[model samples]
Target: MKKGLRGLYYSRNEMDEMVAPLKFALVGKFSSGTPSIARIRARFAFWSSKDFSPSAESLVVPVWVSLLNLPVAFFHRKSIHNIACLLGSPLKIDEPTTDYTRPSFARVCVEVNHLDPLVNDIWLGDDDGDITQKVMYKNLPLYCPTCSHYGHVERNCLLKAPKNKNTPDVDSTSQEDLRIILDKKKSKLVEQPS
Candidate 1:
């Protein structure tokens, strides 16, 4: 892990064995003035200090977002930062974007609440015309809102209540029965006045 964070000037301390499953806390000091380590890529997951809490408020993660079809005029550092602000707290811009080598998209690292519905696109323009800039998030973590936790979606949530045995499971319902139900709803809607 230390080798992975080569230039960041970080110190590692192994947690007590009682904590179990082997965990190490790495504290890094960045000379760049930003406290974010979002650029670090590793096989393991990196959690912030607040992620240990069970509260939904702690459901925040650093994500890499790509602003697609952005205007070349907005490629400047300040302009990119401003555009990234619409998504979340902008951490840092990717090196390629800083150098303007990759014109396809401007990649930025941002810290956003996982619970919030991510923005798909944003309108950007002045008086001349407006263009829809598509937003794409990379490797966004799966989160179970039901359990207010990360790693799994709501459908596979372990905390979800088990279905009643007496209640029929939708998956087990016959195709004919589903068709009849749909027909009934359509008939009822037809009977109603517009």
Candidate 2:
């Protein structure tokens, strides 16, 4: 009954495509024609830093050593470089090193995704190698192809009324009026001169 409910949730095409090969083979042990069952797990990975030199090769790859214990090893192929023992709940790789030179300071750029996206200032390392101070939020403007203006994006622009180009531009007309008035004033001043 549990197998029938699980099968109903996923389409036959999805079950065939997504089910692992090992799980599919295991299902054959059960009664005639039941969909394969496999428990899914997510593995998250992120780099410590991204400023490695192009000349230096074999970037450090950290892999979990055991599920029972919190430990990882930086390995390249079959060769292991360093074994990191995670003591804290949230593991942190302090000053991840490469095969090449180690930098005294590592500059990192952080971005906040919100209503207005921003790129933070360059983070400087302290004596203790800890980051300090809140970085200023620099607004990144969106470019609209339709109006060719920067600031608010395309969708917001469409809601506003379209500008009429058929009528002469206000700036040009104002400049022309000013020129004519100046010419008339100059003519009157010249005629009054002795």
Give me the candidate number with maximum TM-score.
1
lDDT of 2 by residue, 101-123 (tens): 12232112222223332222222
**Residue pair clashes in candidate 2:** none
Q: lDDT of each structure?
A: 0.67, 0.32
Error of 2 at 160 (Å): 13
TM-score of 1: 0.55
lDDT of 1 by residue, 1-194 (tens): 12221111111221122122213423344347643565454312455454375445357778999988666555667667766777887887997676666777889998888757787767655434456677899999888888877888999985796877754567889889878878888899999999
Deviation in angstroms for 76 in model 2? 17
**TM-score of every model versus the real structure:** 0.55, 0.19
Model 2 local distance difference test score:
0.32
State the lDDT at 78 in candidate 2.
Answer: 12
In order of listing, the candidates' clash counts read 0, 0
